[model samples]
Target: MDSKTGAAGGAKSGPRVRFAPSPTGYLHVGGARTALFNWFFARHEGGTMILRIEDTDAERNKPELVEGILEGLRWLGIEWDEGPYHQSERTELYRAAAQKCLDNGSAYLCYCAAERYAGGDHAEEEGAGGKVRRVVRCACRDGKPTSAEGQPGVRFKVPLGGTTRFQDAVFGAREFSNEEIEDFVLLRSPRGEETAGQPTYQLAAVVDDIAMRITHVIRGADHISNTPKQVLLYGALGAEPPVFAHLPLILGADRTRLSKRHGATSVTSYRDEGFLPEAFRNFLALLGWSAGGDQEFLRTSELIGKFSLEHVLRTNGVFDRAKLEWFNTQYLQKLPIEELLPEVEAELKRSKLWKEEWASGAGHEWFAKTVDLLRPRVRLLPDFSSWSRAFFSDEFSYNEAAREKFWKKEPRLPEFLGQLAGALEALAEWNHDACEHALRGVAEAAGVKAGVLINATRVAIVGEAVAPPLFESMLALGRERVTGRLRAALPAVQESCKA
Candidate 1:
C-alpha cells in the first residue's frame, strides 16, 4: 500500500474537493466543519467543491437526513459546484470495481463462519501469567477457505510486509505498518443470497473518489486509520490516490469527544437557537485553523483568503460555547436593520409573541423602529420575545417587586404623575427628546433625581424597570397606553405611599 511515486506531484491545474457526508442522521457540527474547510479550499483556489451523499448503507440512511445535509450547507452558504450525487444511484460503478478486483485476483471470496476464527471462543482461557490474547486469526489464510453456504462473500487480499506511508497535509508524514491491519471484508450478506451482498464503505468510497476525480480528500482525523485501506484499494484498482488532509477532532470543554451531553451538536439546533450562519461558519473555521494574532471574526471571502491546509493544527480543539456566542454577537451587531427586521418578525411570529394588529397595521417603519430599539440589546431571537413583550401587548404586567420598591413607595407620586401627564399632554411634539425634557422637568420640580422619576415612569408605563431607553419606550408605546397604565398605577402608588 505504498504511496505512488506521482502522489506528491505539484498542485493540479484546478483543485477539486468533495464533502461526502453519509446521510445517516442530522448534519453534525464536525461534519459541517469539514464541509466548510473543503468549501474554503475550493473557493480560495477558484476550483470546484462537490457535495456527495454517501447513502449506500440503506439501513442507516434516511431521506430526511439527506435534506438536512443540504439545508445545513445552504444555511452556512456553502455551495457546491458539482453534485449532491447519491452513492446508492451509482451501484453499477461499485459493482464494476468489485468485479474488476475479483477478475484481477486482487480480491477473492471468503466464506469463513464466525466460530472458525482463533478468537471466536466464548470462554476465557488463562495463560501461564494469567494473561490471554484475544487474537482473531483468518480461516481463509490457513488454506481452509470456507464459503458462505455456497454463496460468495468478497474479500480483498492485503499484500504482506513493508509499510503504507503518505504525507498528510496537516499531520505531516505518517507510516502505518502492514502487520497491524488485517485483510477486511469488501462485501458481505445477511442471507445466503447474491442480491443481498453489496460492497462496503472501503470499496465504495475509493470507487466514488476515483469516479468523481476528487483531487483532495479533506476529512476528520478519526478517518486516519481508514486511509491506508483506501490507498490500497486505489492501487488494486490501478487508480491514482487523492491528496489527504485529516482535520483535528472537535472536543468538548472536558476534552472528550463532542456529543449531546456537551451541548447542541447538530447544525439545525444552532440555527433554531438563533445563531447567525456567518458567525457559525466563522467559528467553525477557527476551530482547527487560525488566522494569526488575536483576530477572531472574518467573513466568508476573508476566510477564503486566509485559509490553507498548512495552517490547520493537528491538535484537537474544544468547542467553546462562549466563543461561539461572542462571534454571534459580532455578526448580530453588524446585521443590517433591513435584513434583521424579517428575522425579528419571523422569530416573534414563530414564538407566538407577535400581535396581529401591531404587526400588520403598524407597517414596516414601525417594525424597523422596534428592531432598531432592540437590536443592540439582542443576542438571540428568543431575547426579542421577552425584551419586546411590552411593544406587542397593550396591558402591561407590572412587576410586583418593582412597584413596591419604586413606584408605590415614592411620596408625592400622584402629584408627580399629574404634573408629568399635564406636561406631556401640553407638548406639541411627543418624540423621545421632548418626552425626556418634559419628564426631567417634572423630576426637578419633585426634588428627585431624573433616574428615580424615570424608573417609576418606566414601571408605570412598560411594567418593567429594565427596558428600552425610558423615553424611547414611552414614545413607541403611544400616549393612550402610557397615560392609561400610569393612571391605573396611581391609586396603587398612593396607597403604598400612605402605608
Candidate 2:
C-alpha cells in the first residue's frame, strides 16, 4: 500500500477511521470531539469505525480507564464496528514491527546514557513549560550499531532532505521538513526490577494503525505536529501511510483549551448532568464542523447523512456554555417521557432522593406525574430532582423570604390554607383540572387574586418560588403530603406575621 493510494488501491469504498485514545484518565472534551469527527466521517462514508485504546505506557495506563472510554463513547452514541483494542494486548504486533525495522537497517538500538541525552532534567523543564522537547542524539549513528542486548533504546532513522507533506481533509496541505525532526525513540528497556520497558506511543500507534488497516486517521489538530513523525515511521516499516484529517481544537469561551477549569470536560460529567446523548453529540459535532445552514441540532442519522469531512473547520471553535444549554433545552423538551424516565431516576439516585418503591411500586404514578409537571420547566432532568425535592419528602425546608413574603404577610393565609387543604382532602378525582378548580375556589372566597393563593400554596408545599405549575404540583404531591406541608408552614406564617 502507498501513502497516496490507500488500501484497496485508491478505491473510495468509503473510509475506515479509528479513534485511538490513550487510557490515562476520563476522556476529555477535546478527545470527545475527535471521536465525534471520526464517527461522523465513518458513518457518512458508510465506512467502518474502530475504537482502539492506546494503553502502551504502563505507568500512565489504568485498566479502569478503559470503562471510562467506553462509557464516554456510549454516552455520545459513537459506536464502533471493530473493537476497543488495547495496545498492551497487542504488544507482540509492535515488537514484530520494531524487529522488522531493526532487521531492515531502518531502525537501530542505541546505548546512550540518561545524562548524555538529557532525559530527566530536560523532561522536567519541558513539563514546566507544558511542552515536551525530546532530544534524541543517536549514539549508534556512526558507531556500527550492535545487535544490542541489554539497556538500549530503539530509534527510527528518519530520511534527510525534502519535506514530509500530506493533504489533510480539514486543514488542507501540511508539510514538515526532515531537519525539523530527529531520530525518535521507539522502545525503551524496562525500568522496574521485573518486566521489560515496552514500545513507545509513536511506535505503537503507527504499528497499530497499519496493522488495523486504518485508512483515515481523524483526530484533533493538536496532533498535527505528530503526523510527520508517524509518517516517517510508516516509511521505516515499509508500510503505506493513512489519510490524515486533523480536526480543529475545541477551546473554552475564554479562548483557552477546554479543561476542568472550563467546567465538566468529561462525557460522564455531561451525561450525569442530564444531557441527552443526541444533544451532546450534536453539540460536539458543531464545535468544529457543521451540516451548514442555521441548523444547530440534528439526530445521529441526520448528522451522518449530511456529514462531510471537508466541511470541518480549520480554525479553533469556542465551546459556548449558552449554546450547549440551548441545545440541551431543545432535546429535553423533545424527548419522550419514556426515554426521559431512566435519566430522571438516575439523577434522583445520584442525589440520594431515589426511593425504590417510588420507581417500582404504587408511587410510580406519582413519579410519572412529577416528571410530567416539571418536564416543560426543566432544561435538564437532573434539575427536576433538585427542584422537586419538596414533592418527594415531608421534610420541606421553606425559603425564608418566601415564608415572610407569601406565608406570613397575607392575613387570611391560615384560613385560605385550611379551606384549600379541606377541599384537596375531599377530592374524589385528584387530577390537575380538579385540583386547580378547588384551589381557585379557596382563593376567590378569600377575596384575593389566584396568584396570591397560588404563591402561598407553592411556598407552603414546594418551598421554592419558581417551580412547576402549582395545581399540578399539588396533585402530584397528593392530599396527605400537601396537608402536612401546609400544617407545618402555619407556625412559620404566624412568626412572619408577628415580625
Candidate 3:
C-alpha cells in the first residue's frame, strides 16, 4: 500500500514503521510495549522497523536518557533496521514543511500573547455547547498580523466544515470534526518568526513519517487524539498519511493509566530486577496482543509468526505483576544448569558466600550440582543466592520459623539430629542414597518416623523449612558442611525448644 495515500498501490515491499520515543527519561513499560508491537508487526510483515528519537524539545531532553532508551530496547531484544534519527538533527525539514504550509495558505501567524490567558479574562469567550473556550483561534487568517509587539507564532489553519476520518488498524473507523480540532500550533514563537520550538509534534511527526516513507504507525491509544491533526498536516503537505494502529492503553490494577505509582515504570528496572529478557518480551507481547487460544508462553520467533494487528485487544490491557513473575519463572525453568551457574556464582560472590575453592575441580562440580538442585525453586535469577543460601556458605542464617516448628515441636529433635549427623558423617558414600539411608537408620533407632528426622535434618543443613528436596539438598551441601551445620544448629534448636 502507498503510505502517502493509504491506498493499495505498492508492489515493492512490506510496511515500514518507526518506534519514535522521546528521550525525556528511561524507556517506560508503555513505550517498550509500543516498540515491541511495532517490531513484531514489522517482522511479521517482512518490513522495516526504524528507531526514531523524538527529542525536539532540547530543554526537556536529557543527553543521558538516550543511552537508557537504547539500552532498554537492546535489553528487550527489540532491534531496528534504520537510523535512530533524532528530531533535533532534522530541524531543517520541519522548517521547510512549516514554510510550505504557510505559502499554501494552510497555516497563518497568531499574535496571541501569554498574558491573555490570565485568570477568568479569556473565559468569557464561549465555545461549543456554550462552554468557556480553551482554544481561541487567532483573527490573522488573512495573512496579516494584529499585534506589532513581537513576532507571531504559526498555527495550522483547520479547514472549515466536514469531518476527518481514518480506518484505524486496531480500533476500526475513527472520526473527528474540524470544529473539534481548532487551529492548533505548528510553531511556537512569541513573535511572527521561525525559531526554536517552531515545529510542534504534529508537524514534525508528519514531516518525519513522509521523509522516512513510513507505511504504518503503531503507537499507544493516547496518540489517537493527535492522529486527526497529523492527518490534516499530511493533507496540507500534499502527502498521504501512514496507516494508523493505535494500541490499547496499558492500565494499572486500579484501572487507571500506568504510571510511577504503578511501580517500576522503566523497562531497565525489570532488567535490573533479574527478569529474563525473553520472558519480559513474552510478557510485553501478551500485554496488547495474543496468539489466540490458551498459548501464553511463546518465544520471540513464535510471536513474530503469530502476531497480527487485527488480534490486538481494543480494551485496555491490565499490567499484572503476578503474571509477569509467572513468565519469569517459566523462562528461568527452561534455562540450563550451566547457564544459571555463572549468575548464581556472581550473586554468591556479591553476598560474600563465594569461596575461591568453588571455582575449580570438585568444588566447581558441586557448585553446578547445587545450582541444578535449586533451579526448580527459583522464580528470578537473584533467587539463586537467597534460596541456595546453605549450599554456597556455611555461615548462612537459619530460618527462625523453621527452627521453631521443626526443631522445637519435638523436644528431643536436637538430640536426634545430633545422632543423625554422626550417622551421616560415618557413611563411606556421601551421596543422596547414603544420606537417605543414614537418616532412616537414625530415625529407626530413635523410634520416630523417617519424615520427622528428615525435617529436623533439613532445618539443620539448609537452615530453612522449604528447599528443593531432602536427600538432594543434603547431598549438594556435602557431608562435611552438613555435619558442621548440624552441630552448629543443635544449640539454636535446643534454645528454641526451651523457648
Instruction: Assess every candidate by TM-score.
Output: 0.87, 0.84, 0.89
The candidate with the higher lDDT, 1 or 3, is 3
Clashing pairs in 3: 4-240, 151-191, 151-192, 152-191, 152-192, 187-198
Give the per-residue lDDT of model 2 (tens digit) for 299-415: 778888989987888889998877887888887777777777787888888888888887765688768767777877788766776667776666657887677678655777877
Q: Count of backbone clashes for each model?
A: 0, 1, 6
- Model 1 C-alpha lDDT per residue in residues 1-499, reported as the tens digit of each score: 1122122333445888999999856788999999999999998888778788887787746788799888888888899887777777776677778888888987766666454333322223576898974332355644456444655566777676788887688988878887655566677643544464676888888888887778899999999998988888899999888899999999999999888898788898998998888889999999999987677778877999989999999999999999998888877778777767667778879878775554555665677777787677778777777656777666457777777778755688878987887788878987888888999999898898888778888888877666788888887778777877777778777876787
RMSD of each: 5.1, 5.3, 4.5
| TM-score attained by model 3 | 0.89
Which ranges in model 2 have alpha carbons more than 4 Å from their true place? 1-14, 115-139, 144-150, 189-197, 261-263, 352-366, 423-440, 479-484
lDDT of 2 at 34: 89
- The residue pairs in collision within model 1 are none
User: Backbone clash tally for model 3?
Assistant: 6
lDDT of 2: 0.78
The stretch of ten residues in a row with the least summed lDDT in candidate 2 is: 1-10
Model 3 over residues 1-499: C-alpha lDDT tens digits? 1232232333438889999998856899999999999999999999888888887776646678799999999989898887687787777778788888999999987666564322322234676799776744555655444564566667888877789988799999999998777778887763335454457788888898988889999999999998998999999999988889999999999999999998888999997788888889999899988887799989889999999999999889899989999998887777666766676677677777888888889888877777777877888777777756777767678888887778766788889988988898799987878888888998898899998878888888888887988998876777788888889888888898888
Model 3: residue 355 alpha-carbon error in angstroms: 6.4
